[model samples]
Target: MTRLAMMLSAVALLSGCAGRGGDLPLQPASALGRERATPVDATYQLGVGDQIALAVYGEPDLTRTYAINPNGTIEVPLAGTIKAQGMTIDAVSALIRDRLADGYLRNPSVTGSIVTYRPFYILGEVNKPGQYPYQTGMTLEGAVALAGGYTYRAQKNHVFIRPETGGGETKVEATPEMAVRPGDTIRFAERFF
Candidate 1:
C-alpha cells in the first residue's frame, strides 16, 4: 500500500508540471487566420527598433534611413522629432510633409517605407530557440522551422505568443499558416505523453 501511494503521488506531481504554467488567454486559430487574410485592410504600425527609409522629393539631405527610437519617435533632418509608433507609413510621411511645409519648403513631397522590421523571439521545447529577424508574411510554422523545429516532448497542437503591441500572452493553435508579427515572443509548451 505504501509503495502504491508513493507511485500515485509521483504521477500526480508529474502531471501537474506537464503543461506550460500561467493562465494565458486562449485565442482561436481562426481569429489569427482572419487577421492575416485581410492584410491590406489593416496596416502595419511602426514601433521602436523598426528602421524606416524616407525620401523627400528634390531634397537629398532630408532623405535617409532612420531608426525608431526607444521612446517611439524618429528625428528627421528637417521634420525635427516625429512620433512614429502606432502610426502607419503613410501617416508618418504626411506628418513629415506637413512639418517641412511649416517652415522648410513649399509642398514638400515625402515618402516612407520600412527598411527593417523588429526581430521575433522563440523559446521552450524548440531545438534552437532565440531571436530571429522578421520577414514580411512570416508564419508560426516558418518561425518554428527557423528555431530548428520542435523537440520530441513538444506539444505541437498549440503555442503561446505575447505580441509586441502589449497584451497578455495568448494561446494559439499551432498551424502552418498562423501569422507571426514582429517583436512577438513565441513559446512552445512541453507535452505530457
Candidate 2:
C-alpha cells in the first residue's frame, strides 16, 4: 500500500483503540484532528507578546513590524496606537485599513502575520521537561514526541496535562493518538501495585 494508505489504515486502527479506553469523556472532534479545515475567519489572532509584520502598499514609510506590547497595543505612524491583542492578524490589518482610509491614505490596504507564537509549558516524566513554543494542532502524542519520546519510567497510560487556561490540571489516560497543547504540563505517572 502507498504511505498515505498505510497511514489511513493505521489511524483507523488507532482510533478503534482510543474508543476502547472509555475512562475519559471524548471531547467533541476539534478542527485540529486529522483533517484540515477552513474557517470563516482563517487568520491567526495576535495575542499579547505576539510579533507581527505590517505592510502598506506605496506607503513604505508608514509600514513597520513590531511585537505587540504588554497592553496589547501597537503604535504606528499616522495611526497612533491601536489595540491588537485578541484579534486575528487579518482583523488587525482591516482595522489599520479603516484608520488609513479616514483621511490617512486613499484605499489603504494593510496586512499582518504572526512571526512568533508565545511559548507554553510542559512538564513531568517526559524525557525533556520545560517550555516549548505554541504550535497549532499539537496533541499528547505529538508533544511527547517533541519531548524525546517518554523516558523509560514514563507511564504509558496515565498522562496529566495542566494547561495555561488557569483553571486546573487535567489527568487523562493516554492513547498513542491523543492530542496535546503547548503551554500545557503533561505528566506521565508510574504504574503502581
Candidate 3:
C-alpha cells in the first residue's frame, strides 16, 4: 500500500508539472495593452477583408457596400480614399459624413456596419487548420469545429490565441463557451497520452 501511495503521489506531481493538460508557451492577456486588447465591446472594429455596408441618407449614389482594402482603406465616392481599418462603425460613418460635408452635401447622414468580419486562423493538431471567416459570437470550440474538430492527438484542454492587433499570444483554458474575436489565431497543442 505504501508503494502504491508513493507512485500515485509521483503521478500527481508529474501531472502538475505538465500544467493543466500540458499548456504550451503563450503570452498572458494581462500583458496586452488596451489598444491591442481583444474585442469584448458591442461594436467590432473593422479590419482588412471585412465587408461593410454603408449608407448615405438621401444620397443613393453614395450608398453601397465596400470591402476594406488590404491596406486598411476604402474608396468612397467624392471622399476618395478613407481609412477604415481599426476604426469602429460610427467612426467610419462620421468620416464619410465629414468628407461629404466638404462641399459635397449640406449635411450627409452616413451610417455603416460590418457585413462580415475578417477571418480567424487555426493551426496545429487539427484535421484542417487554416483561416476561416469569422462569425459573430463565435467561441473557441466553434473555431475548432470549423477547423474540422480536434484530432485524436489534440491536447483538448487549452489553446493558444494570438491577437491580430499586435498583442502577445495567450494560452487559455479551452471551453466551448469561451468567446473568440476576429483576427485571432488559435493553436491547439498535441496530447501526450
What TM-score against the true fold does each predicted structure earn? Answer: 0.86, 0.65, 0.79
lDDT of 1 by residue, 73-181 (tens): 9998877899999999999999999999998999999998998998999999999999998888888888999999999999888888888878877888777778888
Between prediction 1 and prediction 3, the one with superior lDDT is 1
Report each candidate's C-alpha RMSD, comma-separated, in the order given.
2.7, 13.9, 7.2
Least lDDT summed over 10 consecutive residues: which range in candidate 1? 33-42
State residue 117's C-alpha deviation in candidate 1, in Å. 1.0
Highest-scoring model, lDDT = 1
Candidate 3 Cα outliers beyond 4 Å, as residue runs = 1-43
Indicate the residue-level lDDT of 158 in model 1: 84
State how far residue 98 of model 2 sits from its true place (Å). 1.6
Tens digits of lDDT, candidate 3, 29-104: 3333321324445466888988999999998988999999999999999988989988888899999899899999
TM-score between model 1 and native? 0.86
